[model samples]
Target: MTTLLGCDFSSAPSRRKAIVHAVGHVDRGRVVLQRQDRFESLDDWAAWLADDAHLPWVGGFDLPFGLPRELVEHLGWPTSWVDCIRHYASLSRQDIRDAFAAFCHQRPIGGKFAHRATDGPAGSSPSMKWVNPPVAFMLHAGVPRLLGAGAEFPGLATGDPRRIALEAYPGLLARSVLGATSYKSDEVRRQTADRLIARRTLIHALENGDPPLMRDAGLRLRLTHSQRDALADDASGDSLDAVLCLIQAAWAWQLHERGDEHWGLPAFDPLEGWILGA
Candidate 1:
């Protein structure tokens, strides 16, 4: 019995905008969300993840695990994943922005960002982007903590083998559930009826195992009415995103249970790690 988690992360977490974590498990072909909680600080969450009590778990975290290999090579950074992350950690946000901006400036207009192979299928933001979503800051803030926590990343590295971590994107799963349907917003007024409907539809799809990955595995999500409403009504969508990642974690666990090697991850670059389910 392995504990599974999905995390909707914020690079800069606070009481106003906390990180949401969905804790759950797969039981008798159902993915159950045991609870959802918020962490107001990354420090607290990192400590919790590093604790011995949290072992024997797999977590799908909504943050990029690696940057584009092209970007790393172009910047003359170390090619080794660990070393590359170390170099990335050493640089300030401004430094990163300038570097990435320089890279983009040298490239053609249609392709301003250097991308990882998984980006094509995952539709994830470029890990180097320092603004908008500021995922670059996420990589800087999150990956180091993951390394310090010593969690294992399948096909990437082995750390606390009982505690596994994988990169995940809720948008990937959400898009599969509801193509081009808007389901969330941070603005109060933008939390409209249509987005709520989209959330309900997405939740139903998960319950019915509508995604090919869920359907193929004969797994469906189980949630109470209140839980569904909470997921739908949260305009920030952090809670719902966390649950989506939880489902992804369950899928990975299923693959592991069935003795599939690499835990369903494709052969990947050692530096530019692959996203789970990408």
Candidate 2:
């Protein structure tokens, strides 16, 4: 009953901002993808996540769980990273935004700030401070809930570490599938074709019984012919992002159950906490 979940997250808190994609794995290694259910708001997503006892899921979130230590120190806040995040949660989002902006404003234009350890390892920007990608906001918006929901923050360890939540980049899998091809587009016509291509590629990979997926995953998208036709009608991969997350989650589930815990590897900042996943 172990299932893997993925979130193609947004910083905003509307139903449109939260989409949950899950893949279920039975006793043996099988991949069963769940439907993409968009929530009405962040609270709805929280409500769903809070039901931790129901579904046996281990999730790989797309947002950063910790901030750069340097960033923490700059704010003259507690040296502990998790403490800083929990503190910010008590403040308004606007206040957090203003503080980060001021921090950045004081820095030199180029190489203005330090980044979270996850960012360097994942090739993503810091998820605690907004600048280019605004991944920082995503962390601000996302992590506290995971913690609140009792999802294991391996590094933080304030919640149930067994709830296992890792940080995964869907791009890693998409790159392997499409190989530098811009198969995921935002334009309607282009995105539609890319999605169809992605779907077929995934299906083909599944039928062949890929290593990550055994031949027994009792879950699927169950896309209708018309749904397939409709998915093809758009060029952006917002939908594709969810599907990609499903696949990524499946991959991570395989490792999480088997991988050795370093208590946080490579970028182990005792304060920020450890990074989990394969």
Candidate 3:
């Protein structure tokens, strides 16, 4: 059995809002939710990834693994994904914000942010956007740590073959089931009854493999009653998002078992990595 992980990442994590990891493995066609781990700091998360005891695991992380090719070219940065990530790592958050802001300033309204090709299929926020979702900062903070841990990103970069990392977006799964219904919120006030209901509905669909995407992948989520309640009761949705990512990781592993070298990801620009399901 292949160990699997699904991570809900934060560029700047603290005890109040830590990075959440859902750890499990695929059994039969079920993606079982074994446990959840939290990291209050990037250092802690990176250390966890580097730990040999955690070796031979494939993980789906909810962060952009690379920047938009257009943004990289516009900044005259190195076209190589590794070199560009190294360059990105050297800049502080303020530096990144300023640079991305300048890039947006040069473009016209409605086209302010450059996006990766996966953004269209994944329905993700632009990787270069420094605000709102702040995925640019996510890419800034995440890619370097993955590199430092020597995690292998299929078709993008080579590292520890035992530690495979793939880009994942939980929204791709959630939106497929719930459409535009908002299922969770970080703010207490925004955690409405309807959102809670939506979460339950989404979870049901996942467990039963009701969605075409889930059925096609031949994967369903398996959670204990306590686990089910916990995932639904968390108003923040971080735990649930991590589970969604875990499911994606399981789908990738299924493909690998069938000998898909790219782990089901299509041919994509190495400088702008593709999301696992997208």
Winner by TM-score: 3
**Total backbone clashes of model 2?**
8
- Candidate ranking under lDDT, highest first, comes to 3, 1, 2
Cα-based lDDT for every prediction: 0.90, 0.59, 0.92
lDDT of 3 by residue, 55-92 (tens): 79999999998888998999999999999999999989
lDDT of 3: 0.92
Question: Which prediction has more favorable lDDT, 1 or 2?
Answer: 1
Q: TM-score of each candidate?
A: 0.97, 0.76, 0.98
Residue 137 lDDT in candidate 1: 92
**Worst ten in a row by lDDT for model 1:** 152-161
Clash statistics: count for each candidate: 0, 8, 0
Using TM-score as the yardstick, the better of models 1 and 2 is 1
Give candidate 2 misplaced runs (Cα > 4 Å): 15-17, 129-132, 185-234, 262-267, 271-278
The residue ranges of model 1 lying beyond 4 angstroms of the native Cα positions read: none
Per-residue alpha-carbon lDDT of model 2 for 122-197, expressed as tens digits? Answer: 4455556575567777777787887788876555555565466666666555554455566555345564655667
Q: After superposition, how far is residue 257 of candidate 2 from its true place, in Å?
A: 2.8
Q: Candidate 2: what lDDT?
A: 0.59
Q: Residue by residue across 1-278, what tens digits does model 1's lDDT show?
A: 68899999998899988989899999999999999979999899898889888668999999999999999999999998988888888888889889999999999998999899999999888998888889989999898888888888777677887889999999999999788888998889998989988988999999999998799889999999899888888887889999999999999889989998687799999999988888
